[model samples]
Target: MSTTRTRARIATILAGLLVAALFAAPTAAPAAADPTTRHRPSPPHVVGTATVPVYSYADAIRESVWVETPADSDGDGVRDRVAVDVVRPREAAAAGVRVPVIMDASPYYLCCGRGNESELKTYDAAGVIAKAPLFYDNYFVPRGYAFVAVDLAGTARSTGCEDVGGPAEVGSATAVVDWLNGRARAYTADGRRVSAAWSTGRVGMIGKSWDGSVANGVAATGVPGLATIVPISAISSWYDYMRYNGVRRAADYPGYLHSYVNGRGEQACADVLARLRADSAEETGDRNGFWAQRDYRPLAGRVRASVFVAHGVNDLNVTTNQFARWWQELAEQGVPRKLWLYQAGHEDPFDVRRGAWVDTLHRWFDYWLQGLRNGVMDEPRVDLETALGTWTTQRDWPAPGTRDVRVALGAGDGVTGTLGGRGAQPGRERAYVDESLSEDALVAEPGTGGSGRLVFLSGALTAPLRISGSPSVRLRIRVDRPTTELTARLVDYGTAERIRYDSSEGVRTLATESCWGASTAADDACYRDTEEITAVTDHAVLTRGWLDAAHHRSLRFTTPLRPDVWYTVTVPLNAYDAVVPAGHVLGLVLGQSDPDFTEIDDRDATVRVDLGRSELVLPVTGRAGLPSVAVAPSVVTAPAERSSARTAPDNRQVP
Candidate 1:
């Protein structure tokens, strides 16, 4: 099985097991409290220059508390109390210096450790942290920042149930920020009310994967104190995590994650898990209110905080489309943001880009949290890593002036069809059956006859073409069945061998150690050795797009096409960075089904392609100076919240 397929098969199990990983002081005057409510000034009154260190980690203060929230998700709860473990420079207490807060509220704290060390939080009898995960505190505490590791709302020494990415999850994190900023209240485990002293109330949330997803969700709430967020490889929608388009993925994955995150054995969260499975709409594989509540993009316009988004282009664990769509939403909101795109798979930039990641992150924090005069904002907005392991910077992503270049598919010698920019000549329609097939099986040799798929090829290119963004497939076709799944892959066909991402998920780690930042005995900013992902092979599948013929008109509504009718649907391929060398050819594969996912009904359907009407649209990089046309939406859709789904003309993103 392919590495991606394997991960999808055991997504919840691996996500639960691999969840490890990864917070500050106040400097400026606190934001005003409501005149109706009483308020007290924050602790540590003095402040220092942003460029210099103001506190000492060796003599830092450690403490823990329970923050009270308004909701009670767990049945046995009396409202929710979030556990917060804090570490900050002793200088703040000794000399009355103030610092900003950096927090990482995570559910992984109790079940899986964080970082390469898999370090879980440890506390002394006084309920103070004896050990915290990663080096966020070790490196930043001395620099006058308070780092707090929160155990989310549940799972670790806190009250309430873990609702995955539901309302409770988002509310819990925002409540903590509220308390720090003097808007909400917290208490000691002994039932004593506590307040967040030693804080400027300026908070910046950062984390990877699940931990980061929480940050994104919290910021979407438009929380006041959250000044900025850095979410690495985070999921924008939980639905996208478990399902793709309108197809149900590997079975039992969502149930497994919910139960595992509860960490109180199967019986403890069986009801919650059961409820999740029931509400998922897995039977119809359609988008519902359950998934809509967890999606953050809709809340993007309300976000008041700056965002620094980062994700691996090769990440299959949390597919790239989720990030692409979310990032675009943030851009449309006109939020102050920066982006870091890497070439590696499901790994953190702290490990992938190391030196640069740290330096940039430090400046980012200093500028936002400390109100520093640093020129961080003046720098380029996009820091992207290409497939070759090299780096490039641009003013913005989608690289400013990209042009959508269309390549039409024409009739060819029976098996492989011709694909190019030249207008396609009218030709006989090609047909294919819907059958679950592996990527390799569908993309055999050029002349290889296949009953399950159709392969179309573009002549060897005389000049290299760099594609910076997603490519949409516009196809006009007729299918016999009411609903049939369509899978399209934009591939680079070359004689030279390439890395098989299916083998090791694109990258592997070595035994040697590569230190990223400063370190101590219990905590180190360094990590195990690593190399860029590679494996010389023949052809490389660049990107893929999927659609359900019946639901092509709308992801929420099932509108199957009439047997003899010809309809047009534009499918947006998953986002990726690919450069076709001068001598390599580009191939497009039209397959009925991908074995990687379980779409259930495997009914065979014959599809007839309208050669003259359909075309492959490529976002050719460095064509900004060229005349650019307005790009179409990923798919046609309707306002999805209502009972009957209709075409939502503005809804464009579809995969």
Candidate 2:
């Protein structure tokens, strides 16, 4: 049989087995023999053989089953199937119980299907989990909630392989919820009261990376049943993911495409990848067209579910700017949202920090689905200030009192005063040699030397410097070449070690007015000067400008383009600090290119600093002797009433 036919046969067999089991299991109570009474709703038949005896809510629920639903919900041309796992309550307690439901859409294809059954079950049974190394199912099922893992429509045992975003995927998710409700009723032995369990109807969603993206998409449907969502490592802008800033992200694109197409033995994904690969750079550049169609930002307002967006501070694959855009857009629409920034990487999902994340999810569901009198709703909406690893709550993201600090770059050797400048002065420029590396270095990995880079350090801070908000840099530079690339990185220096804080890089393509058309030439002149012209090279360039480190010149005046043109580039530093302790030092590292990041190569790339024209700007927050503040200890409120004490209210502040 063909793959589709084989899958269909398996689904049919599973459904038949479930029906048989339902018929075989003795009913707890019998209804009247009257046809009318028989016509009334009977306990849902438990179709599949019970691999594990049904237990109480306390023991832990773990059962894998395939849910059958009409492939075509609306008699549409297309059809699909949704596979789900129903994790029952652990202990054998009362029947009529309302438990929270967590619907996790798996990112890895194997984890949700038979291919990964053994591994998933091991984790499910063993209760050990990590994001990068292991599948997510192991971590979720043991958490005392019904975890529904959906195989989506086209992967593993499901039908239809068109993974494109639309009704198909959404319908699959909806169908899984319906199936879970039925299974929950069946597991409750058809008790009328038990069938009315809280989770049988209420459900929430949470996932990381691809799973997270799906959660965001499903939430956008405004599905009434979906109570809340926690999307981590999810990019809001599809355009940004496929094309960075604006340029096609050559390095990551092929790998991602390959994973979706061939990773799961799903044939349909091959076509989608083909189309994506066939699209030309120009075709992909039109953001308002098909690219926008794939983006989630346009659908942000459509998402009615409360959301907790988590992103890493140093996610090179998906920059922090993307998260900033997501937060800003959601806020602009007045969506109930929370933002969590961590000092980690893309694969941080499976990290131990996930325990805290899972706890947060549980509290959110308890508040929304259980209608508990938990203070989850009243807790600060934002958590985690990057510099400070500790959890800090806030009313909103980019909270009040966020200050911007400017750090200057100047020509300098190891630790010399020769290139000293007191905040913005023009001087004779000196160039530093550019070095290139054979291979790209991992951004998070320390101490792999590469080419065209400069490092500058600030004197040890006298007092604890807590910098929050974005970091921007202004630099004076001249390049021997017509066009150059520049990269800047902010580093927090420890006495024994130096760690990367945040970085941004970009490239500058020189403009030759002769190459432009009459209309284009006019526009170019309007933006660019003869000595230093700024032309509308391309939006892609601007998008790449988000991280390009092509050129930097003194900000003093319009320096003429000579043998080496000196121009100043002002770069924004988005990442900031809550507090850099007094003992630590602040450092800035500049490079022509970040090998571990983008492959922007510039030979003979030399950055000259007129020390007389440089200064390092730091944003300092005024401190009050560590004020005493009361924080809620738990995510949810306790059952018993505690002493009524109110803490001094600090008007939700952010700069």
Candidate 3:
């Protein structure tokens, strides 16, 4: 839980020398004045936006230096070294105006590149960067910020073996931040010292996915001089990213990904890659020390910077739980924060909601870096996107003052059972085989119990209801086997067609273009037009949760079940903000396996549910924020149960 646990200083420290482009010779322009001074820009917030066009887009300096780390992740015995690419306002450096830095540290730069364009960095003859990936430099350097693109240890131009998401990867990135603050060192190719004279020593890390995950890792160190971070769709725990409970989302998923993004020939880092597979403990899929070392949630209280968190509800890749758990820790620590909960999947906010995202980022950086009174911190803390692309600003996430509404499961006259029933169903239990099935099949005709799942529905909604946060599935059940993994999904089923968000991965790029900032031949700030990915379907998955029966006691510890023993377990679903319209049936699908997520577990165990003690607890803001749908009737009644058996406390928050 402490930074010192894996901290090891690199011995071959190199002082940061002159950064080429940012340290360019003096220019002859009024806006680009003070070239002789070489550090500060003429005016701060000159353009006053993320796209402020002041610096030369074509002239932003692009250079690279190596940063050494103590971990020999490459297994070569020699400590690993990281490659850092810098792009900054040449005028700011020339003017002697030390600027705060915005950095994107990533391992994907070598393989998948970055952003929607899939851009990989282009290098010059001397191994310096000729062109960097993405639009951060194109857009922000002009606005007076230095942008650093770092190649994590063992990836891209860096020297080392890959350790996947282990300490080597985390420590290597942290070393770069240390170098920026003069707490560590960096060196040029010719062995020249490179001092960060062009920097204020204040840094803000930003990125999506793996890139963003690094940002979280660095901040967790409780390091000084890291001013802020904007982690978009990032991983808080590598364990959560690849596994749920004791069952894996995919066996050795990180090992496979580590090899893929390493860029080095497989043979060069073969031992490192092999070790990842062995250390991953894929067979048991249990949480181990390796997972704990990569976990950043426990270090939340140590973070010194403000956080701007963003995540999409439909991001099956990272899932909402990863973000929610970290965010919860940050809240408990009382760290300055802001959030944007979108409706897309595995996406970047800049790509989904470009303009607003940029403006907010602009203000955020200004307030933090330049010490401006932009009122960004004073604004509503949460901005939520709806299923239809509409948005709302909430005072706090989960819509402040909300409570849980428990809906019990009961068998109805039809195939699917009843939800929000007053008592247990006519049957003592409902059962399904542990056959793998797509979510589509499980919810397609919920009324007709699918082969792999049992669906329970509430009466036709009399009024619209929306869930602002995560939902939990509390079930009291007995299993015939010693262990089994269970999956539960919250869905909406009806005749009306809705956007098939999951089909297209939540976004569809259009033929047109949407420009964010200025552009250059090497990197353009414009991207393809993207509209909300939509579809007509009878079902829409609101959220889902999973648990290993063995993990029913604790994710950190395994407890094999005793057959025929009834146990009450609580499973927290991913967080979401969606409005379920009136007349659309709300259903809960309980199944043993999901083909898209879990691998097949051959041990089939019959599960017996005590319906009277099981229910789905939903977080809702009492009849508010449910616009565009008809109101519910006062006296609601379903075909199955007459009185509601919602046995849990009402109007009380769940955990």
Candidate 4:
């Protein structure tokens, strides 16, 4: 036997034996004297903390249905119908046993696909689903769970206009939960009405990226029958996806993404697409009704389902701020939640920690969906990656002893400044011309005055410095132009090997495959293994923030700056966690028009900063001032930085 097949067989046997040894209870009673017992099918097997595989995966029933929704985004005068595919154990119907659901709703099923292999859904000759993408169906169907795949409205086989993350898109997915609970109607491919007779109506939604975002929106609605949600690298707000603060990072993003996901029925959706472009208002980049409809944070108080969130600290596509704000809101509402923080970028936990991830997820589903008395909730609430391949368990995020440390930016050579100093020179000021340049060119020299960025350096740390939350920057400044994009970066200067997040999302697929459950010819349960990618670098950008000067006061309103007049603006950087080495130097860079993250504009603008009034507030462990020191004036050299793409972080083509 080949090594791959042998490993696959071993893994399957181990997972089965794990639960069987723990409980070892008969699932069904022996056939009785009653004649009716002979015709009844066996029930699902149950163990101590999970359901063991007792049904045949190949014989599971596979079919498709169209669910009626209230949204008529396409303006066809008829209500929109969402496409839903289902795979469940045959025993669910024959033995009169109703099973729970595991659902993944996404627009990527047709255009971009799902998982590391990018597998698309395939159909059989009967026009029914043959091969469903990913291993969800193959693994969970035999364990007494129904797996559901939904083609979001306006994408794939569903009908309607893709409104990005607005009401239309959210309505399409939530309608499925309503259908399972007997609150909505559904029909077969032949237009015959159908009902979820074999379902328990307990749903758990899980996915990555946009698929995960849909789960967030649906959970915010507090729909009945939604047991829990597992959102990996998901976005909490649509405004944060297209821009940061008031700076527009991508122009006409809604229209561009809509075109990417919906390649068919263009004419029918022309009006909807046009409205998406106008409502986004790329020119102003201010928050309005369109954005409010898509924001999920305000509705956190209404969420009834437990949440399990997983995010990559270095993920620049959806970014860390999304999960940060979502986690905070869930906590404030006193909701049950769990979190997993990794060191990669834009990837799933199944790809990073395959074995542990599967085990934990299995227990979580058993507890929430099956009502098992498992100890999954008795463990720690947070799992954070401290370094490459190393993890630690914590009671909560932001480490318990973290405090905000205020560091002064002192004028040092009229160009570069000193951080963590005793006091600042109030009368001293630094000036820089706003121009388009790579981050490497802007942060090149620490002691020189020839660059277009104002740099500040702290002395070499004698002890390790660990930051665990979002960092904020307060700048008192005046600009030569009425409006310009303002940017700030927190950097680490040292020579070390770190996860290569910018390269293939820090993972490489291998030839060897690992199987999770039973399989068949059309849909299998095995997938290619993956390994983390690392690189040796001199420096790394810890976090960055951007803002439009005109909208500094509020994300909803804009007031152009008065040339030569000082304005105090606060820029909040992305949330992150890192431990700087004892000998590494912490640096801060302030500039305009970051070519790597923001749109380039107003090249002739110039910015001036009052060194005394500006400060950086960081959430650090131990004494706030213990990890910072003033750098010697003679040490002028700094390390070069790396840049990432300024477009969407997916593999699909964009306009």
Considering every candidate listed, which one attains the maximal TM-score?
Answer: 4
Ranking by TM-score: 4, 3, 1, 2
| Predicted structure 2: clash tally | 53
1-655 per-residue lDDT for model 2 (tens digits) = 7999999898778755554432222220111222233344322211121112233322344444444444543233555544455554544224444455777765344543221111232234333211111222333333334556666665544554433433445556656665545542222212122232436455677766656766777776655556567777775655556543333334335334444523335344556445545542332233444455446666767665667788766555556665676677677776667777765545333241445665665456555444443466567887773432356776765656654444444333332211112322467444554453211221111222233344454454557766655555566666665434455555444432212322211112224322111111111111111121122210000011223333123221122244445555565544443555664445455555433344434355566766445544444456411111121011111122221222212211100
* lDDT (Cα, tens digit) per residue for candidate 1, span 1-655: 9999887778655433322100111122212222211233333322332444445555678888888888887655588888998888887766666678999988888678876456788777777787788778877887778898888766788777777788888898899999888888887768788888778778999998888889999989887778889988888998877766776655655666666567455565566677788887877777888889889989997777788989877776777877888889988888778999887666678767677888898888887786654677889999987655678888987877777888777666666677764434554577888766766666656455667787777766677778877888898888898878788988777755444456444556778876543455555556676566676656777888777777787777688778879889777788887567876777788886665543444667888888778888888876421111122111111211211111112211111
**For candidate 3, lDDT tens digit of each residue in 344-463?**
888888777888898888888876665455577789999998656688898788788778877766655535666774647434676666665555666665555445667777667778
Winner on lDDT between 2 and 3 is 3
lDDT for model 4, please.
0.82
Candidate 2 global CA lDDT score? 0.45
Ranking by lDDT: 4, 3, 1, 2
Please provide TM-scores, in order, for all candidate models, with all chains considered together. 0.85, 0.60, 0.86, 0.90
Better of 1 and 2 by lDDT: 1
Which ten-residue region of model 3 has the weakest summed lDDT? 646-655
lDDT string for model 4 (275-311, tens) is 9999886788999889989999999987777789999
lDDT of 2 at 243: 42
Q: How many backbone clashes does candidate 1 have?
A: 27
